[model samples]
Target: MADQRVAIVTGGSGGIGRASAERLGADGFAVVVHYAGNRDRAVAAAGAVTGAGGRAVVAGGDVADETAMAAVFDLADSEFGGVDVLVHTAGIMPLAPVVDLDLDTFDRVQRTNVRGTFVVDQLAARRLRPGGAIVNFSTSVTRLQMPGYAAYAASKGAVESLTLILARELRGRDITVNAVAPGPTATPLFLDGKSQQLIDQIASANPLGRLGTPTDIAETVAFLAGPGRWVNGQVLYVNGGAA
Candidate 1:
């Protein structure tokens, strides 16, 4: 594994993060599959990586906790030697209109989505090797202005801004920092409270006429993590034209 690349995929327990962890592993990355709380799912993700003839390990932490996340990067160093990519997909999404959203809920969303991103990105920025990539997650709803998504959208807007400044901040380090703003997708996060009719309506509104699959977003994460070198500081909307 001397010449192998290593990827630390946050939120690897499920959804787009799980798909991305497996994809990067298939692409020959030694992976650190990170989870917030789900050990079983994270182990399965690591299994997928190793089953594909790649090296992998499981790490768990709250992304906003510096000590917790630092341990995760240390695991990468100890187990895989070094880190080359950070696909930061760990986040919380709760939908509430601005008026109805409580201060506690708003603050919690900010802490997890905004501060969590900052913490992980900070670790990635410091620890990643030259030519490494940092991919953060955003949402197309920031532009679509969907009702009941104010808290989430505001958080992602911060992510987009952070992605840009961090890319410039890492100038000449040969690291690429970008954000993936996925549109309406079929992940549990996206499907959890909506009705079938609303889901169908969203699918129909997309030019592709379907909800995006987790693998669809994962493919783009793989690209940004690897060969998409020229894509720094940009937010790629992976919404099938829904935005």
Candidate 2:
């Protein structure tokens, strides 16, 4: 096993997850890129880490499944000694007003966003090495109170609450638990099906006058995971002043 610290980033195939994984690798953590279904992208992310003079491996599992999550932990133990950091960023956003939101979509979103976070964090609480950190993903929409985001916002609200409580619960372990609430980021998922006019309008809504980038959020994650250890049990909003 590598003597370097190890970090496992779920949804590491793209967007904020990928960016955070890369940043953590560059920060000297041996990263494990976890993906649900994108093998190629996961491999690419691992390659990026290795190319940057860090150790990395690709692992796949459903974040919401206990058995799968157990396997993921096992992989980390066998491959990198043990997990020193855990970042839960795997989530699905199916935007719809509460009145029109499909039951299936709502359930899936809750499963991935809420339950997945709980499962992964439960494992982390039990297994993370002392001084390790757990970073959960939330949304600026939870504070922005935007339309068509009731379900998504509600899910992230749970994550925010969980992070705070988990921090206290793990107080003896010296593990810091925190959440990053990102605003309108320019990810593929966010850009899909949006016109330039709509995108520009959204950009103007932020004080920064542009949508957030994955790197923007990733930098915050890196901080909370690294030298920002004192920032426990808080939701650091990286929305360019949108909230």
| lDDT of model number 1 | 0.94
Clashing pairs in 2: none
- Compute each candidate's TM-score over C-alphas: 0.98, 0.98
Where's the lowest-lDDT run of ten residues in candidate 2? 1-10
Report the C-alpha lDDT of model 2 over 61-106, residue by residue, as the tens digit. Answer: 9999989998888998998899989988899888889999999999
| Candidate 1 lDDT, 77-195, residue by residue in tens | 99989999999999999888888999999999999999999999999999999999999999999989999999999999999999999999999999999999999989898999899
Instruction: State which candidate has the highest TM-score.
Output: 1
What are the lDDT figures for the candidates, one per model?
0.94, 0.92
